[model samples]
Target: MSVTPRTHVRTTALVLPAVLAAALGACSSFDQGTRGIADALTLYRPEVVQGNFVSKEQVAALQPGMTRLQVRDILGTPLVTSVFHQNRWDYIFTMKRQGVEPQRYRLTAYFEGDTLARFDGDDMPSEAEFVQRISRERKVKVPPLQATEDQLAKFPVTPGAEPASSDKGAAPSGAQPALSYPPLEPAR
Candidate 1:
């Protein structure tokens, strides 16, 4: 038998790792119960945070210069409102999460000369002008009045509601100031 060269043996050993790495990377299917391994490596759950808005007060303080988007940022999207007047928008949010005091909200915004100027229905006003107009004598349905540490801790409204993210697994991990008025995007 011819003698095997030590150099040849070393070269063969060097290539063995690369070959195994390529083959393992290309293998997509596995013949075992290890499919759960991939799932365990990737898991996520959405955390839902509810708002506390007392209806019948905040809904009535809308003003002109406010766009449809601005209202959506504040009280969230409405359930239903007058379709005849496009300016009159309504927002409704559920308060009860799993049988804890059922929360219901309703807000109506009125317009003058085709521009929103007034509102009424439900929800407490958070604006100074609206607060001034509201009479403490009548029952005023409003949010927590002032955001608390707990309320702010969860579902804390960030300025501009923050832009929606398309990238995966990215989340703000701290309390952020609520966004100021964001200009309306041009209709595409």
Candidate 2:
């Protein structure tokens, strides 16, 4: 059968995508098993912090024969508590940061009667260590907390100062004397 221009166009259109697909497939093989597109385009994975973060300090503070209330005060609250296991309190912490390896910790506190019998769990990091572990090492230079003199100079403080009159060398119309204020900081 003689092919018309329309048929030729249709044939080309169909073959073009197949050829492109094959080309793309071959290109992907050369990616060395790396995530080609996904690596280039970043997806936002939120910083997920789930469950109770029981620090070493908090865990250290827990003592045998401590009351449940006392344990709660030190460790905040248990993440998991089972009705079947009424005497056991589990503090599970999981932190999934973007670049850092995900962290999971479990601390189980066993209670005898109303007092803590014993507790055991993974090695918990200190509050400072936890902070460092979760924090991203950004090269940001944080500005000083104390303001510079120049910055303070911009807003010249005049206690109860009135607006200047338009007329030259004229006493500010209906202007009252400046009222003094107590020092911002109390005397040491």
Best-fitting candidate, scored by lDDT: 2
What is the RMSD of candidate 1? 22.0
Alpha-carbon lDDT, every model: 0.57, 0.89
Models, CA RMSD each? 22.0, 13.4
Worst 10 contiguous positions by lDDT, candidate 1: 45-54
Candidate 1 CA-lDDT value: 0.57
Which regions in candidate 2 have their CA more than 4 angstroms from the true location?
1-35, 137-188
- What lDDT would candidate 2 get against the real structure? 0.89
Give the TM-score comparing model 2 with the true structure, all chains together.
0.56
Output the number of the TM-score-best candidate: 2
Tens-place lDDT digits, model 1, residues 66-178 = 76666656556665656685666655444433324554555566655444676665544454533433333565566766876987789766786765668665665465666
Residue 143 local lDDT, model 1: 72
Residue 149 in candidate 1, Cα distance off native in Å:
25
